[model samples]
Target: MPKRRWLVAPPAPSTFSARFPQFPPLIAQIFYNRGITTPDDAQRFVGMEDVAANARIGDDPFKMNGMSQAVERIRRAIREGEAIGVYGDFDADGVCSTALLTEALKKLDAKALPYIPHRINEGYGLNSDALKDLKEKGACVVVTVDCGIRSLGEVEAGTALGLDMIVTDHHSVGNELPRAVAVINPKQNDDAYPFQEFAGVGIAFKLAQALSDAQQQSPLPNAQTLELDALLDLVALGTVADLVPLVGENRTLVRRGLARLNKTERPGLQAMMQQAAGKNRSMSAGTIGFFLGPRLNAAGRIEHARTAYKLLTTQYPGEAEQLAAQLEATNRERQKLTDEMTQKAREMVAALPPGEFILIAGSPDFPEGIIGLIASKMQEDAYRPAIAMTHKDGVMRGSARSIPEFNIVAALDECADLLVRHGGHAAAAGFTVDNTKYDALHARLRNIAERELSRLELVPTISIDAEASLSDMNWKLLEHLDQLAPYGYGNREPIFLSRNIMVKSARLVGTEHIALVVSDGVVVWDAIAFRQKEALPKLAPLPKQVDLVYTLASKVWQNEPRLQLEVKDIRVADL
Candidate 1:
């Protein structure tokens, strides 16, 4: 792995800190780093104040462009007893969106049919064959979740088949919007929605909220209703898993959703927790991202996403347990496959002459499912944009992962003529191309990356939120930071820098981790440096002094709760 650049955040001005007298200086500085400048904003961010009321128009689902039209059409479908198909991508975000919307529609007595495309066979997003299948199964209306923003042709084909298309996606929009009945994407150029970073499931939740509001105004006798909060578990799962910025409405949703998730009565989720995490383990954003999300996603990456969708929606405990076990096994297999392919990809990149702006690796033997994982590993290890492709039968499918300096999707857009289908966000994207165009596509993307990134430093950087003394480490400080729960993507855990700490004792923990006891003379703390065993030689030879960048966490060992430093980076102290 490339050594990361450390960028320490500048301290907030004293005048700015004076506005929030209640916060500790450290807490205030951390909040300022997160763009929380005012006392009111701080209170809202920490949940001391009502987030929804302070959200202006952002919390109101109807304010989103095309929301009203989508709700009206969906209500009409419910009233007319027309079958509605909820089509979703294969990833966790897409699967959760499908389950959330399908459950919500079913609550309103709508005939909801959920469909998630297979990763290998059908690929991502809306497809003509899937749409036709839904139509044949009596679906008069098809609502796309998490995908379809760039699928103009697919939407047209569905519309031509008399399927009223309502697209609810969160991906970056294409040049022209799909000709659908209603397109509910906050990222649209003309959208008035104040918050635009909702994950696909977030948009689906908003649609459900709108439907619930509509239902309340006009009574549908004998129609079942669902509490909006009930669906938040799914929202949190998808929002966090999709890696959307957890700020604004997304943060609020995840905050409340985490609460729901910990107490979720969904048998499938409970079973999954038992299989993956302990049954008693509390669900956090980390839990979802590291444990639950991967297992849910493993189904899509390995086989079919419907297995995960079923696990989320099933009411039977027995079936949930079975499905959860299957997912666990599949996730393990996925991990093994990813590791093997990533090594292969690294070898392929290593053979190239150094200093390439972007790394491209392809193999005929690469599994279609884990290409994205391989690309992500390559990008992280190399600190450059990486694309992993798998070729089969004169066609190629590639998944791209990019650094902050490069927009992978935009680069793909520049080579549109060479692609059969392509869509994604700034940092990640997927594309399909004929084998004949693969070389041209790779060259065009490489040129685009080089032109955009040649002038800049390309190394990955670890951002340090503030500098703190070891004395500042305590339960109180950890509690203050805990207010910023459900951290992911945009809203990250605060990383603090503490310099010249003595490593009193150190030992290797796991294969690539170091467990250490450190002190700043008067204050001693337990710390763990993950994946940093290679740097052990620098800290070892005992009582070595070093500068450490880390996050604070409370962990239980031997039935006791203790403060532990989760080290992000460590370096030798300057003489």
Candidate 2:
């Protein structure tokens, strides 16, 4: 592991506690450190959007460029009893969107059918064969979720075959937009919607809201039970899994969705929760990202996504139980494959020169399904951008994961002429290149990495949000910090950097973790640093004094709750 470069922001205003008179000084400092300075900003940051917390609950659905038109077409389909097919991608977000929209349309009286392409065989987006099949099955309108922003050719194919498309996606748009009945993407060039970072399921929720509004005015039969809030369970799963920022409407959605997820009435969700040992435990964004999302995504990674799809939407108890069990088994297989690939890829990269800017490893023997997982591990191990590829039938399909300093998708877009198809976000992307262009693509990407990565320090960094001591710790302080719950990619947990800590005892646990007993001389705190056993050598020596960056966690054992320091990083004290 490389040494980490610590980054700390400048000191907060001394009058923060005076400006926000409702809280203590410590809480006010945290608000300021998090960029919430004003009373109104502090109110909203803590999800107090009711009193002075109004920081834009959610953007108006009608403000989106084509939302009104899409609503009109969807309303017509529901009234006429047309077969509405929802085309979805093969990821967790895609599955959740498909399930969400399908359930929404079903309540609105449309015979909505979900059509998810197989990841291994059908690839991604709306393929022509599936579109043709849906049309042959008497489907009149097709809506895409989490995909189809770049499927101009397939959209045209469907239109020529008399299939009307309503493209609802959140990915980037290309030079030419798809010709469809209505395109409801916030990222559209003409869209003035204030927030453009909605996940695919977030867009679907907007459509559902429009449908609910139409239902209320149109004297629909099920108008009284259109609790779109219930569908928020789907939104939370997808939003958290998609890695969208949990700041504004996304935060409001996840906070509420997590509540519903913890007490979800859906048989599938209930069974899966019970299977994952979540009977009485609270569910947070981290819970979904770590446990639920992986299980939902395991099917897509190995074979077909339809298994996970059925697991989420199924209403029968027995079927839900069976699907949940299948998914658990599949997830285990995914983990095994990922570990096996990572080991092999490690050896492959070990042979490369130490000064290489990027880690690119591939083999014909590698399974295409686990390439993304392999790339992710390599990026973490080397603290540099990494790409893992698999070769089959004159084509190379690969997944790339990048650090904060590099944008892999932009790099792929810059060298688009050397690839067949590519699309993704800043930190991760997937692309396909011809076998003959593999060397050229690798060379071009390496050159770009050389120009970009050569200038930046290659060590990982831990950002400290505030400075505090053990004397300030108390139950009330922990309660104040609890307001910032449901943290994820954008909204992270707060870390405090405290100096002059003594390490009394340190022991290795589970091969890679370190359990420590430390003190600020007045109070002793039990700390556990996961995956940082190597730091024991630096701490076990005589000096004893060290600087610690850590988050406070409450651990319960035998009905006793105690505060534990979850160590993030440590270094010798600045004496």
Q: Spell out the clash pairs found in candidate 1.
A: none
lDDT for 483 (candidate 2): 85
Q: What's model 1's overall lDDT?
A: 0.90
Residue 566 displacement in candidate 2 (angstroms):
0.9
TM-score of each: 0.97, 0.95
Q: Alpha-carbon error at 117 in model 1, in Å?
A: 0.5
Give the Å error, residue 63, model 2. 0.9
Candidate lDDT (C-alpha), each = 0.90, 0.85
Give residue 61's error in model 1 in angstroms. 1.6
Tens digits of per-residue lDDT for model 2, 1-575: 77888877566677666898877676786777777878978777775442122122376788987888888887787778789999998889999999999998887778887999987677767899999999999889999999988888899999998988999998877667899998988888889888888899999988888777767667565434567877888999999998988877788888778877877888888888788755765688878998899888888998788898898888899999999999889999999989988999999999998898999999987777788889999999999999999988899999999998998988898888998878777898888899999999999999999999898788898877778887676677777777887788888887888888888888899999988888888988889998998888988675488898898878777778888889999897988
- Model 1 lDDT tens row, 54-85: 12223779988888899898889888889999
Clashing pairs in 2: none
Per-candidate clash tally: 0, 0
